[model samples]
Target: MHSFKRVLVTGADGFIGSHLTETLVRAGYNVRAFVYYNSFNSWGWLDQSPEEIKRELDVFAGDIRDPHGVRSAMQGCDAVLHLASLIAIPYSYHSPDTYVDTNIKGTLNVLQAAKELGVAKIVHTSTSEVYGTAQYVPIDERHPLQGQSPYSASKIGADQMALAFYRSFGLPVGIIRPFNTYGPRQSARAVIPTIITQLAQGNRKIKLGAIHPTRDFNYVEDTVEGFISFLESSRSIGEEINIGSNFEISIGDTARLIARLMNVELEIETDEIRLRPEKSEVERLWADNRKARELLNWQPAYGGEKGFEAGLAKTIEWFSNPDNLLNYKANLYNI
Candidate 1:
């Protein structure tokens, strides 16, 4: 296993990033959390993490888009888990330029910095959205990438950039592509959170878009575990691996499932404003996790028949808390 004492987690303030950061700290690793600089000094979900994790963390606030800032934060770190990217698909449609600058350019900054810093290994985050509407079921690393939306297109560019650095410069990098990771701390813009928050706010009629599309949902813990597996294994260098539950469910069904778990009967409303452009909607995604198993010795523990149901129970518990539910604006359509 590759060993690194000090690791930098870019985007460490976000949902998955915060969980990964906390997990690493608990496992006795020196974690440097590079959060996006904001005047409010917000660390996103990291702010709500246990105080013990916060005490030991070296939090560096900086923008991923700034090469100088990235380099400054990365200095002395052995490895970087770059998860900083603009990911809202609907927002991307309205502002593709911001996605390009943040996702593409921000990725470039990390790659160039890692090369210069001589980092031992870097885990570059990718998304299953890059394989738009999955041409084949059980989408593997070999699946053709389709840029169906601006978000996926920017991620495709970033993924290619990471690969180019690996192939051309021989940078030790692994691309971890996760499918629809959902759990506590996920923003309201996400489907699961939107559904949960709406129910928590006593909305009997849930508003959603493009309910026909199917997704492979992997819990946040499972997704973070995949990153650690790659970080510890040298076999994954210069390769792209998938981290996902090898199962599929339509969006509408997922909403209904969450409702059942929360014990809330609801009407599903199709909000036209919430729907993606018809041509841009991804129809389906089901992960072929064989490569992750073969290469990283990883399989999702939170997947299969009862995995999603169990995960939803945990997520519902989190969102049901008045403290957690208050942070969300359930009445407003997020993004």
Candidate 2:
């Protein structure tokens, strides 16, 4: 673990990646942030990070699809957290080709670069979506892979690619499969943000998708800690670890929880425009995090009730500010 002096995080500008990068920098590791190359020169959520934290980052603006750029970014980095991908399930339905290129090919670029650069460790991010609905109570690492949507299919392919590098090329890699992670800086495309933002906007009616489906929500900070824990623990080298809270709640219940926390009585009308195709809905997901507990020595510090409180509080505060809500489309339904 001590062999790594510098860590590189791909997708460092997104929600979870930004949080993990901040945590890594605070942990005294020299951090490199691999954000997407955009003409706007924006850092996404990293732009919203405290100036103190932003000062420590080595920002590299480049696209993950470019092999040259990926390899160059890994040159001096000892470890890499590959989180770059197009992850919206609804958007994937409309643009699956984009998902394949960004999620699958983008991952290949990172894995190959890590192998060529001899990076000590590569933590490839996976999603619980790959498991689809849980066939059993708690979906373990052995759960059969299911592609309920194009986004999940791309992730499954990406996971397989990273594992192949570990087996065929002896590249040190591990897959960190996090379930539904929600917190501050998350976009309105997600359910938590949608509900909070709608309520914060003073709308009595909250627009939402299939509220019947269940999810095991883990706060972003806990998810980031699990990623750090994986780097320090040798047992996770070739493992597929699930970073989850081991608790489940339906979307309808979740909306109610948020409303309760915010002291708002609102109707959760099922917005047909927000719903996915009937077959594409993932029925349920609750993770068996015993592997994460035993191997990473990690268990979620925030449960559903507590996580909801903190997340909703922060989300409400963020959305209450019109400047922030200006970026969100509160009038429309987001899948």
Query: Taking the tens digit of each residue's C-alpha lDDT, what string does model 1 give over 171-287?
Result: 999899999999999999999999999999889998999898999999999999999998998799989999999999999999989988888897999999999888899999999
Best TM-score among the predictions, by candidate number? 1
Candidate RMSDs in Å, in order, are 1.0, 1.5
The candidate 1 region of ten consecutive residues with least summed lDDT is: 1-10
Q: Supply the global lDDT for candidate 1.
A: 0.93
Q: Which residue pairs in model 1 clash with each other?
A: none
Root-mean-square deviation of candidate 2: 1.5
Question: What lDDT would each prediction earn against the true structure?
Answer: 0.93, 0.89
* Model 2 lDDT tens row, 233-307: 898888999999888899999898888888989897877778888888999999899999999999887865776
What is residue 46's positional error in candidate 2, in angstroms? 1.1
User: What's the distance in Å from true for residue 108, model 1?
Assistant: 0.7
